[model samples]
Target: PEEQFEPDPSKKNLVILGTGWGAVSLIKKLDTENYNVIVISPRNYFLFTPLLPSCTTGTVEHRSIMEPIRSITRHKQAAVKYYEAEATKIDPERKVIMMDDNSDVKGTANKTEVPYDMLVVSVGAENATFGIPGVKEHSCFLKEIGDAQQIRKKIMDCVETATFKGQSPEEVERLLHMVVVGGGPTGVEFAGELQDFFDQDIKKWIPEISDKFKVTLIEALPNVLPMFSKQLIDYTESTFKEEKITIMTKTAVKKVTDKTVEAEATGPDGKKTVEVMPYGLLVWATGNAVRPVVKDLMSQIPAQKDSRRGLAVNEYLVVQGTKDIWATGDCAVAGYAPTAQVASQEGAFLARLFNTMAKSEAIESQIHELSSTLNLKPGNPGEIATAIEAHEKQLRRIKDIKPFHYTHQGSMAYIGSERAVADVSWLNGNFATGGGLTYLFWRSAYLSMCFSTRNRVLVVVDWLKSKAFGRDVSRE
Candidate 1:
């Protein structure tokens, strides 16, 4: 039988929040034996969010991209404790985290506090609605697994409801219209996937609503994918035109009702016009908003008051105005875009930093013990002196850790119909390309980025299954 794992009282309690890309990456590479590692998050699984849009259209199964937190922790050298709960507050002064078990099932003690010598805040952001009226109630977000499932169910529901007996032409049009807001990667990828579902399967299966089914992508910006090069952007726009997906640029959604979306569109002449469009499924994917916990923690730090996006962090990823707290991912203003690539890099950096710190401390302890022994003995000092000098030299080397630096890995997004756009960083130069080959690259890149071997296998299987049998359109 396996030995029971216990926390070492002598070691520092390192608490990590969230199971997203950043936190999971840190945990995966961290030297858990050096600290009493404790992970706390509402989610018990680490979700591969880039592939999340695929889940919406059943291109990939939700579970296929989800790697359980336990599966990751169980392989660590030392036992890591995981709490399936939400961290409500962080008391910097007391070094304690107030957490609540927000899940349906609970024991006698649901609310508690966990003290930590070091804290890492990597809780990802939430969907940004921009205070748009009726958006929270009407629109579906593509953030989590549940959101994808909701979208998958709503798509079929709308189709079945539209094809019902004696359905009005106007109502049928409304039910078949899928409106996607935001021109970012999330919105663009989802819109492409949704369109693919209709073009490849829905149109073939339900010919009655073939022409009526349409996808309209709404972006407040002048064009979608602002991060990409102009050439790639034009290629994406032209590709969307060929795919028959309507691209409404320079249009900001002002309000949304249960069945209609009201937006203000700016013309080339700079004149703005309010247009109301009916839709069955409305996906709001503009961007991310700061989570409440992160906001509250930022409020406690005077240095973070001016930080609008998230908790301001120094080059070392340490939260400003705090010595022991560090922030990463979407919840951190680390002079980088809140992309998975950035988060994972930051997490790995932190792991290296902490491991080096632990080594430095151990060396310091050894030097202190050796010096004390020399002081007491006062006889054998030659070997002890050499040993202390060697330890000091090694400590200096280990302590000279550099600041965190992010490497731009380029960006890729699927634009549907077996095509994709990529602005790749290759050989110290930018290489922008878009087409079917880029789509294959996108697929391979995402597959390689999957959390675990199991995830990669499952995702490949899902893709093959979907391609062979079409998406499981059955509403659940």
Candidate 2:
């Protein structure tokens, strides 16, 4: 008979939510044998979000960046139970989470409750529309694999429709106008990729409509890439200008329609004017918003009432006003920007904390047992006392675990025409650079950060293939 494994009744039930960067990083570093681990997420795979923009234009395939969660858990020493289901509600008082299999093909038992001794909420965040009318229904979000696939299909659809026989000039222009909202990294990188696609592949295949093709990046702030240094920001703006990609700063998108976007633009003289711009594809990358599940949990905790963005976490990442529960990634407001780097570091910190906690508990139990033995059996008192003293000393060393601290590694973004920008932290100093050399550094850095060797190889192959023969423009 095959070896059978079951949850250890003595061990704590460690439940992890979501399989994104934070959750996956935690799982990778966590000592699974110490606890009966259970993972629940609607997505069965972990998505590398940094390279997601490339997927929109077929520069990189979506599957190349996706690592199966089962592969990650299978290598653990102890068995880990994984459920591909969305966590519906978290009942803190009951210490149980209500989850439902929201997939299309579901069994008779789709909803159930999973009790957890300790819970981690790293479910991440959703796209923020800011209550803009028709945004959700009309615009495509570039957060998920499905979203990228949709945008890919829409891009070709727009191009093919624009080139139809006897197509009106106005309709063709509208169909070829690509509008990207929000000036964050996601928005900037995607605009760059889209423009590259037009210049490299689309233009070569369909040259007749090349002159009409346009990419516009809209930002509500005074400039794009607010997080980058002033020099790098200026470099990006100038590069975009050379590439003929329009950058509309100080403009707020008011509404979205199937064929048009209404926005209010601020002029240099302090005058504001509303303009309606026609667009074929409207990609929204306006940052993250709190998920419904997170919002509901926050409502239950009195300490999180004042927190508007997400669950406010303490120095150690524990959810405020609660113990045995932690938050990471975009779902937790830990005085850090919601980026993959921040999330991964936070997850690793939590893993160290939990590991140390387990060790400390085991030492304390051993000390207690040895003290009892010393009282009951006086013959081996010296030996037992020495062992107890050693254990206590080791415990003291491990118990002094410090609070979580995030170290900013660096920031990077890809611009078009084989150029990139990077603000790296090197040798206690900042190194900010942009251009072709930085682009190579950006590629190597992301390739090294891939989830697995398999991912790294596939990404490299995709990059080479795209460059050798151009991107796959077939609509999915």
Model 2 TM: 0.99
TM-score of 1: 0.99
Taken over the whole model, the C-alpha lDDT of each candidate is 0.95, 0.95
Instruction: In candidate 2, list every pair of residues with a backbone clash.
Output: none
TM-scores vs. true structure, each candidate = 0.99, 0.99
Stretches > 4 Å off in candidate 1:
1-3
Runs in model 2 with CA error above 4 Å?
Answer: 1-5
| lDDT of candidate 1 over 1-476, digit per residue (tens) | 22246889999999999999999999999999999999999999999999999999898999999999998999898989999999999999999999999999999999999999999999989999989999999999999999999999999999999999999999999999999999999999999999999999888889999889989999999999999999989998998898899999999999999999999999999999999999999999999999999999989999998999999999999999999999999999998998999999999999999999999999999999999999998898998999999999999999999999999989999999999999999999989999999999999999999988999999999999999999887888
